[model samples]
Target chain A: MSLDDLYQSIILDHNRRPRNQGPLEGADREVHGHNPLCGDQVTIRLKMDGTTITDVRFEGSGCAISRASASMMTSAVKGRTTAQALTLFDNFHELVTGAPPAGTKLDGNAGTPGMSNASGESTDVKMPRELAAFAGVARFPLRVKCASMAWHALREALVG
Target chain B: MHRSDFPLLAASPGLHYLDSAATTQKPAVVLDAMREFYETSNANPHRGAYELSGRATDRYQAARERVARFFGLGDPDCLIFTRGTTEALNLVAQAWGRRELEPRDEVVITAMDHHANFVPWQQIAIATGARLRICELTPDGRLDMDHMRELIGPRTRVVAFPHVSNALGTVNPVADIVALARDAGALTVCDGAQAAPHMPVHFDTLGVDLYAFSGHKICGPMGIGGLLGRRTVLESLPPWQHGGDMIQVVQDEFSSWNVLPHKFEAGTPNVADAVGLAAAVEYVDGIGLDTILAHERHLLALATDRLAAMDGLTIYGPPAAERSGVLSFTMADVHPHDLATILDADGVCIRAGHHCAQPLMRRLHVPATARASFYLYNDESDVDALMRGLQRAAALFAVAGSASD
Candidate 1:
């Protein structure tokens, strides 16, 4: 799909029932993120195994890009190993930052190795290429924080 | 749309300014008054004794008298000129909070207070080794009266909060809250920042021991505001800031402070801003706060109606009738920043973020929101313009991800 179509889908899905609209019961982890100027918040919850992400969910509220982004993130990162998830995180950041594909986006980074989940969805999708829908967020400098809120919350849960 | 008298209404032509809650547009009269001061009466009043000096003093003191009466204050001497609400609050925290409280004593403040009112008392409490108590508001934005009564006992020394919440637009029951604290033997401090510009806040009638307001938000010049202390409260508290024009005697070993208002005003105060504020107060008073409030309320109601009617709009703050002009919201899938940017393109300005109330945001369970705040300058046209902007923003987002479609 074109960049525009990708963005439309993201918004459509986000506007529908948002992923993790409310908190999960008996969840392993929960962390909060907020933007102080306009008062938006989101909390992240992750159920992880020894070396694999067992289940990933988000429970919170925010604008379209953020809520939808969290939904997409939950979809994209689940069942992936920690190292692969980190690479996807890096690619997502690079995509929003508009970095050249010469490094990560262009290469068959996921296919050359065993980067698929139990469902066999390739972990090698350089999210920047697919997630390029959020590039418009980069055009508006202030919205960058909205896109980053979930990512930041997720990073805290994992690295900690 | 824009008030003709306000220069900043269309200051950046086609600029949709939604940050009035932060500050407001300055009217031409306020600007002229300030310019008139600098051009004609540049002499320092109260300190200098010349022709121009006397003229300056006359106008300056007259402005003070005007503000005193505006808030139902009888004596201008009871009014202390400060930088703005922040400074006014800090002065009280230092002069009263420090001098009065014991190490284990407590000061009760709501969770919704702006940092200006919240932090000063916190610092003062820290300095005095006094404790700072939090009186969290209920989910619906009212002060928890039961919690308040439970909190303010003998150990509690003062109760401070905003008359209207800057974030929630909650018009707290000031008289009731003040009475509660007063009966508990505690001083009452009310930050009038959010309330003063939107409504007629009578300091004397509010019965708050100390009332603070900034001039800028009320279409006055920046850097000038006042603190109205009860006559008895003014008499008990020592002036916090010390310098020229605030001293009765300056001996080699020690110095004695001057009386009342001047004692609180140190150095060369914001004289020009004071003149502008006075002019602003006169303008609001002349227009009748009834009209200003009625107009703003109408605009707020119109905006909220249009927004709440939208397919995916979720709004924050009080109900349209209960809240003032501030309307915070988020579209179904559009982040507030994205909404604001798209709105900006449509020549509508708005503020997107936490609005300086992080705690309130946590309670609302959302990060950042698009806030279309109305003011005296905003009219029905602006509200309609915002409605159009929202439609445009939704349309823009609707077509965003079509990479190849």
Candidate 2:
């Protein structure tokens, strides 16, 4: 019963009907990320319009957290600049891992300011509401990798 | 069951541990033996000249003798102590494989083997320019004997396989396979990491040229294991590691290696864990290996029956009669990782991954599986808890208006 915090309705919904869940046709950049420990793999494909990600899609098989994260990630990063998506990755990472990416500040615009962390205390950077469903991942340390599998692939695809 | 003998199981009344294939819980006797060794005979073995060092050497030698006797080996000098099965296999692969295998030589392995048994041979094959051939598995998860007979030929120099598959729990016919290798003039290396714990394993009877097993998997302490090699085979290879203990004469330009087991065991050996492993062997012997095997078979049957009756679950491996003590499966809607998490919430521990048999998982067409392995400590209640937890995972993922909905 206590697993409700980790597996929210919205997350499960996205997992059941994943958006952008197939290979993107005419995609310019594609990157595959796999966690050899769990065998969770995510392939992120992007159709980049200059510096802007005009279209994004994913293809892979994994747990609900990873699948749903990839589903929500595609919708969240579509039509966004490469810089904005990287910023969102930082915020999403901090939300689940309880720590921001090393050597980078969480510049505003990833979430609503002054949102509460898992302990009901206000945090410096807030997470987008849909991504906030994964904040409970911080409690279950092992699932953090599952939550961030897609985000890591996206970061790799963008930077490379 | 002998659950009470293990301190951790005795302390945690609510824990239902089904992950013995990863490593078993150490009993109090094994712990006490290590503590006793440290308290009384604490000194570096084979070096010190004082009385304490003599006692330490005696303890270490006595452990080797106990281990040799337990595994039905005639010569204790053939047993080389290692950190675990990984190191032992690496030693064989590096020392024997590098020296014996020529560019056109062939090495045979099975697809269902754990990476410990598979990778070392792969690396050695690459290093030596030898051909690495893998024996395929049957649909029921047993090794395809036809494929094996085809792979092992005149050029096959070394054949390595697991006695019991860590992922599928398929118990291999060790002596039969060893005979095939012998007929082909190839040395056989058997990885007994998964088999030595739940069942009786006799090195001399198995007829394998080299055998490796881990202490932690056999309810012994970690960081200590033994590689049992034939006397002639052990003498034919070079020493794996160099330094303190494995030398006979150190010259300015060249050095001569020690004989038999000492030639393989270099540096300060893990004396205390070795003593602990011997005590573990004694404790297991006290319980009777036949009784342990029977108990685990009963548990495995119960688990298999329950899991088979479950609507959405599909169990891997051969029939319950063919398997040792492991049950690997997958649910329809829930991922293995998610299923493991749900089971853990109910204090039921199961392993969920590729189980270090990535090639086997690929052959099975599943990325990973959920495995629940039985041991001497487990009983019917543990199986019941596993069922309850699996049902919880199913309901959470499938039922309308449930948490997922």
**Number of the top candidate by TM-score?**
2
Across residues B302-356, which tens digit of lDDT does each residue of candidate 1 receive?
8888888898898776677888767878787677766776677767888887776
lDDT accuracy of residue A27 in candidate 2 = 97
**lDDT (Cα, tens digit) per residue for candidate 2, span A53-106:** 999999999998899999999988898767667778888889889998785433
**In CAPRI terms, where does candidate 2 land?**
acceptable
DockQ of each: 0.25, 0.46
Off by over 4 Å in 1: A1-160, B10-16, B395-405
Clash list (residue pairs), candidate 2: none
In terms of lDDT, which candidate is strongest?
Answer: 2
lDDT of 2: 0.90
- Shift in Å, residue B55, candidate 1: 3.1
Chain A of candidate 1 scores what in TM-score? 0.73
